[model samples]
Structure formats: structure tokens, C-alpha cells
Target: MRAFIFPGQGSQKVGMGTDLAAASTHARELFEEVDDALGQRLFQLMREGPADELMLTENAQPAIMALSMAVLRVLEKEGGVKLADVAGCVAGHSLGEYSALCSAEAIPLAETARLLKLRGQAMQRAVPVGEGAMAALLGADVAKAEDLAEAAEADGEICTVANDNDPGQVVISGHKAAIERAVAMVKDDKDRWGIKRGVPLPVSAPFHCPLMRPAAEEMEKALTETVIVAPSAPLYANVTAEAVSDPALIRSLLVDQVTGRVRWRESVLAMHADGADHFVEIGGKVVGPMVGRIVADAEVMSVQGMDDIEALIKSI
Candidate 1:
């Protein structure tokens, strides 16, 4: 069985979808439609970037989704592969969930783009810059990362594990000072913590933690008003790390994901356990490496440009 996955934030670049748009009319049309839906020349920004602007949370979220969708559209149009017929399941990392849903036709492309823009804006607005921060813990599992966070967070500061990415990687999000303290603790107490390093992430806000409750509330309202249908294939939710197909359940999970840990490691393990032999990364290569760590024996492929897509079609 083949499983398609989409990448989340931090996977975007200046010219990510340009090659796909150039190679496929379907991809170009999808980019144009997303630009129209957002009422901004997002494609232009994506094509030519100063790097700083494209990296902004408000811009990066939808930009990542747009590239993923554009790639998916090209695959569908050129490869003669439809989601319902070939996919055993679908999943995405963080905002990539919207892309997965769009691939499964659970949500329209325009709605998916608009929702991501709003989600990014709300998440950015939830915390002031430099006040909240996120950090990556290398050579540490979720349990050790949690202990490090607990030991570091003092004076009522909030710090929690945000993403359980893979076996040796975990990310923590919380107050900037708390994050710094966590880094110090992990670095200072090597024997006790068993953490090789704690690297701070460049982000506007501390995401997927309790600090994002305001963002979660905003997403709840937006999702409630948006139209959602049952997906063609099961989507492995970030919060649950399991396959879910019900529209209402998906809505609830999306809202919760704002302040919940992204259990990507377990999600990949679950898909691999269910006999998904090949895992195709649709948008970015960020999650592709993590999938490799989770299911080393499974055939993992990252599809980016025309060559990669064509090769994927031939391989499948």
C-alpha cells in the first residue's frame, strides 16, 4: 500500500513550487487560484523572495500548503493517479494536514489556503515576538525532553513538548526564558538528561503549546463556519497519531492541534504497521527524513520537482 504525506512549516523556500508550476498547467492553475483566494500575489512572492518575508509565519504556512497542493495537482493530472484509488491513507505535518485534506477532497483548495493564512496570522498574533520561543532537542526522546522541560520551567513559566518528531528528535515550545533555561539544563546536566543539544528555533511564537489557546479558540470558530466533507482516505491526525475520516472529528482535532503535541513519530509507525510499504512525501523533504527514522525498512520517497514526480510515477 502507498501512503501520501505532506510537510508542515519550515519546509518552504523561495522557489519551492516554481518548477511544478512551470511543468504542469494544473499546478500553475492551482497556484493562481490560491493567489486569487488570498487576494495576494503569493505566487510572485514564492517565486522571488528576500527569504525573510517568505519565512514569516503568516506567509510561510499557506505558502507551504500551496506548494504541496500544486505538487499534488501535478501528480494527479500527469500520473493518472487519483487519491481514492491508490492511497491507503493520507497525513501531514502541522499545517500540512490541510494539504492532506485537500488532497483527499475533504476541503476545497481555496478554503484550505484561506484557512491556513488565517491560522498562521492568529498563531502569530497569539504571542508577541521574542516573548515565546521553541527549541529542538537532539539525541533525546520525548520522555527525556519532557523531564528537561519540567526541570527548567520555574516561576510558573510554561514549557511543554510541542512535537514528538522521531526517535531522537523532539521540539519544545514555551516562554523564551523558560526555553533558554531548558537549553541550559539540558546542556549543563549531560549525564542526567542524556541530551546532546538543545537548539532554539527561529519562530515568531511558541506553537503547539498552551500559549496557543487563543489561536485554538480562533481556529475553532473558523473551522466551525467552514464547510468540510468526509475525506476519500483516512488522515492520520497530528494530535491523535491515528487515522480519522469523520469531518466533525477532523474539525475538533484541528482546533486541538493548536495546543497539542504533534505525534508524528507514532503516526508514521502506525501507517507502516498497517502495511504501507511506500511513503511518498508530497510537498517538502522535512518529514521525509523523520519517516525514514520511524520506518527504516519502508521505501520512502520525497517528490519535489518534475523529475522527482516522474520518477515516483514510474516507481509506483
Candidate 2:
């Protein structure tokens, strides 16, 4: 069985999809539609970057989705790979969930782009600059990270484990002071727990923690205005780590995911348990290696461009 996964933020860079757009008319149409929907030239920024403007959450969110969907379209139209026929299940990381839903036909591409734009704006506005922060605790298990978060919270700081990425890799997000405290705790426990140094992330807000509650509330309102249907394939929600198809449930999960932990490790385990033997990462190569670590027996493929797509076609 095969599962298609979409990448989240931090996988984006300048000139991400310019070649794909130029290589195929289908890819070009996808970019044109996204531009029309958002009423801006997002593709231009993606192709030729001042870098800073393109890196903003608001732009990166929709831009990544557009590029991924464009690549998917090229594969479908030129390679004869139908979504329903080739994919058994679909999942995504953070904002990439919106892209997965769009790919699965649960939501249209235009609506997906619009919703992500709003989501990115709301998340960015939830906290001020340099107020909240996120840090990655490398070589630390979930239990140890949670304990560190609790210890940090005892000091009246708001810190919590945000992402259970994989075994020995967890990310904590909250107030900067709390994150600093948690990092200190992790370092202190390094010798005893066999943990390495924690790496701080460069993000505007403390995402996937209580600090994002305001963003969640904003998303609840925005989600209500948008229409989401049952996905063609089950979506492994980041919050639940389980397959969910109900539109109402998906809506609630999307809102909750703002301030909730991203259970990526558990989600991958669940997919593996459900008979997924192949994992195809679309748009970015970042998640592919992570999936390999999480599910060592599974065949993981990262499809980035035409050559990668052709390689994937040959492999399958």
C-alpha cells in the first residue's frame, strides 16, 4: 500500500517551483489560478526572491501548496497517475494538511490557497515578534521532553512539547523564557538521558502550543465560512494521528492543531500499522528521510521535480 505525504514549512526556498511551472502548461495553469485567487503574483516571488518577503508565513503557506499541487497536476496529466488510483492514504505536516486536502479533492485549490493565506496571517498575528519562540530537542524522547516542559512550566513559564517528530526528535514551543528554561533542562539531563543539544527554530510565533489559541479561534471562524468535504482518501490529522474523513471532525481538528501537538511520529506508526509499505513525499525532500527513520522497512521516495517524478514513475 502507498501513502502520499505533503511537507510542511521550512521545506521552502527561493525558486522552488519556477522550473516545474515553465516545464509544463498544467503547472503554469496551477500558478495562474493561485495568482488569480489570491490577487497577487505569488509565483513571481517564489521564482525570483528578495527572500525575506517570500519566507513570511503568509506567503510561504500558500506558495508551497501551489507548487506541490502544480507538481501533482503535472504528474497526473503527463504521467497518467490518477490521484484515486495511485494513492491509498494521504497526510501532511502542519500547513501541508491544507495542501493534502486540496490534492484529495476535499477542497478546491483556490479555496485551499485562500484559507492558508488567512491561516498564515492569523498565526503570525497571534504573537508579537521575539515574544514567543520554538526550539527543537534533538535526541530526546517524548517523555523526557514532556518532563522538561513541565519543569519549565513550574517556573511560571509557558512551555510545552509541540511536535513529536520521530523517535529521539521532539520540538518544544511556547514563551521564549520557558523555551530557554526547557533547553537548559534538556542540556542538564543530556549526560543522564543521552540527549544532545536542543536546536532553536527560526519562526515568528510559538506554533503548536497554547500560545496559538488566538490563532485557533480565528481559524474556527474562517473554517466555518469555507466548505470542506469528505476527502477522497483518509487524512491522517496531525493532532489525532489517526485517519479522519468527516468534514466536521476535520474542521475541528484543523482548529485544534493550531495549539495542539503535531503527532507526526504516531501518525506514521499508525499508517504503517494500517499496511502502508511505501511513502511518497511530495513537494519537498525533508519528510522523506524522516519517514525512513520512522518506518525503516518502508520504501520512501521524495519527488521534487520532473526528474524526481520520472524516477518515481520508474521505481513504481
Candidate 3:
């Protein structure tokens, strides 16, 4: 069995979908549709960037989703492949969940684009700049990360584990002071926590922590107005790390995920345990290497451009 995965933020870059759009009419059309939905020349910004504008949360979220969907569109239309035919399950990292839902047909592309734009804006607005921060813990697992977070949560600060990415990496997010405290603690005694080092992330806001309650509330309201159907393939939700096909549950989970830990490591393990030996990463290659580390022997492929889509078609 095979699982289809989508990458999250930090995977986007300038000229992300340029090659795919040039190679396939389907990809170009999908980019056009997303641009039309967002009412901006986003594809142009992506193809030719000043770098800073495209890095904005509002732009990057939808831009990443658009590129991922473009790759999927090329695979379906040009390669004559259907996602439901090959992937038994689908999953994504952080914002990539929206891409997974869109690919699974649970959400329409236009609606997905609009929702992501709102999500990005809301998350950015949730915290003031410099008041929040995030950090990556190298050579640490969930337990050690949680302990470090607990140790750093002094003076009622809100430090907590944001993402359980893999066996060797975990990310934490919270108030800037608390995150700094966590990093200091790691530097002071890395061996005690079984971690190598703590590196601060260059993110706009501290995401996936209690500090994002306002963002979660915003998502709850937005998701309530949006319509979602059951996905054709089961999705291993980022918050739950379990396969869920119920539209109502998926909606609730998506909101919770705003301030909840992204259980990516557990989600991958669960998919592998469920007989998904092959993992196909759509759009970006970031998540594929993490999957490789999580399950070393599993077959992993990341589809990005025309050649990748064609290779995937032949493999399937």
C-alpha cells in the first residue's frame, strides 16, 4: 500500500512551480485557477520574486498549496493517474493538511485557497512580532522535548512542543522569553535532555501552541462557514495522528491543529503500521526525508516537476 503526503511551510521558495507550469498545461491552469481565486497575480510573484513578499505568511500558505496541487494535477491529467487509485491514505505536515484535503477532493481548490489565505492572516495576527518565537531541538524525541518545554515554562510562560517531526528532531513554540529559556536550558545541559542543540527558527509567529488560541478561534469561525465532504482517501490528521474520514471530525481537528502539537512522527508510524510501505510526497521534497528517517526501509518518492510526475506514473 502507498500513502500520499504533502509538505508544509518552509518548503516553499521562489520559482517553485515554474518548471511544472512550463511543462504541463494542467499545471499552468491550476496555478491560474488559484491566482483567480485569490484575486492576485500570485503565480507571477512565485515565479519572479523579490523574496520578502512571497515569504509573507498569507502568500506562502496558498502559494505552497497551489504548487502541490499543480503537481497533483499534472500527475492526474497528463500522466493519466488518479490519487485515489494509488494512495490508500493521505497526510501532510502542518499547513500541508489543507493540500491533502484538497487533493482528496474533500475541499474544492478555490475554497482551499481562500481558507488558507485567511488562516495565514489569522495566525500572523494572533501574536505580536518579537513576542513569540519557535525553536528546533536536534537529537531529541517527544518525551525529552516535552520535559524541556515543561522546564522552560517558568513565570506562567507558554512554552510547549509544537511539532514532533522525527526521531532526531522536534520543534517547540511559545513566548519568545520562554523559547529562549528552553534554548538556554538545552545549551546548559544538552546531555541531560539527550539533545544536541537548540536552534531558533526564523518564523513570523509562534505556531501550534496555546499562544495561538486567537488563531484557533479564527479558524473555528472560518471552518464553520466552509463546507467539507468526506475525503476519498483517509487522512492522518496532524493533530490527531490518526486516520479520519468524517467531515465533521476533520473540521474540528483542523481548528484544534492551530494550537495543537503536530504529531507528524506518530502519523508516519501509524501509516507504516497500517501497511503503507511506499510513501509518495507530492509537491515538495521536505517531508520525504523525514519519512525516510522515521521508517528507514520504506520506499519514498517526492514528485515535483514533469520528470517526477512521469516517474511516479511509471512506478504506479
Candidate 3's C-alpha runs over 4 A off are none
Name the candidate that leads on lDDT: 3
Clash totals, every prediction: 0, 0, 0
Displacement of the residue 15 alpha carbon in candidate 1, Å: 1.4
Residue-by-residue lDDT tens digits, candidate 2, 10-117: 887999898898789999999999999999999999999879988899999999899889889988998888677888889999998898899899999999999999
- Cα lDDT tens digits, model 1, 92-129, are 99998999999999999999999999999999999888
> How do all models score by TM-score?
0.98, 0.97, 0.99
- Candidate 1 segments exceeding 4 Å error: none
Rate residue 25 of model 3 by lDDT. 89
lDDT at residue 251 of model 3 (Cα atoms): 98
